[model samples]
Target: MIKVETGLADFDIGSETQDVARHGGGAIASFVGLVRDDGNLQSLELEHYPAMTQKALYGIAEIAKADWALHAVTIIHRVGKLAVGENIVLVVTGSDHRKAAIEACSFIMDRLKTVAPFWKKEVRLDGTDQWVEERQSDIDASKQWDE
Candidate 1:
């Protein structure tokens, strides 16, 4: 099972975990990203082309599933304005063992950081806004999975 969702609504982590557990995998690993209060930022806004974003997210999940033989994969990302400390994204991977479950979740998140089409802007408390640039560290992490 592979599920992908993008919206403004916050996801229920408990429910998502239960759903993945029902798939009868031996282990399930998850990653949750939350908005940070960096640089005196007030809030963050994420913009994306809906259709394209969905396709990209699904593609990332599919690759992880194939490589890990995962029993289940779930990815949820929020768009639009998000307050500091709010949930930004969630990724869950289930497999017959712990290593695949853990590694697949990391791979999905690393790839999403580099491959997802979302545009992020930092809204500062000082009445300034700036577009976020992709970090070199993220690119390197994603490439590690390919090798």
Candidate 2:
């Protein structure tokens, strides 16, 4: 089972976890990214072309499924404006073994952060806004998988 989706609505983590678990995987691992409340932050606005975003997300999930021999993989990325502390994305990976499930979850998230075609802007409480830049830390994290 492989599920990839992008939209403005929030997702239910419980249902997602259950859906992956039902696929007969012995181990399941998941990650949920949330909008951080930096002192100046009011909200985060996310944008992406629908076709490109779906294709990219599906491609990443497929790679994880093949490389890790996963039984199931799920990725959900939310777009549009989101309030502080809202869920931004969810990644779940399930496999026969713990190591594969855990690592694949991390792998998918790393790729999503660096490769997914979503643009983000931060709106400050003071009414100022700025586009978010890719951080060196994120680039470095994604590079480790290439080694």
RMSD to true structure for each model, in Å:
0.8, 0.7
All candidates' lDDT scores? 0.94, 0.95
Deviation in angstroms for 73 in model 1?
A: 0.4
Residue range 11-37, candidate 1, lDDT tens digits = 999899888988877999999999997
lDDT of 2 by residue, 1-147 (tens): 999989988999999999999998699999999999888899999999887898899999999999999999999999999999999999999899999999999999999999989999999999999999999999999999999
Which ten-residue region of model 1 has the weakest summed lDDT?
Answer: 17-26
For each candidate, give its TM-score against the true structure. Answer: 0.98, 0.98
With candidate 2 superimposed using the best TM-score fit, by how many Å does residue 96's alpha carbon deviate from the native?
0.7
lDDT of 2: 0.95
- Give the TM-score comparing model 2 with the true structure, all chains together: 0.98
What is the TM-score (0 to 1) of candidate 1? 0.98
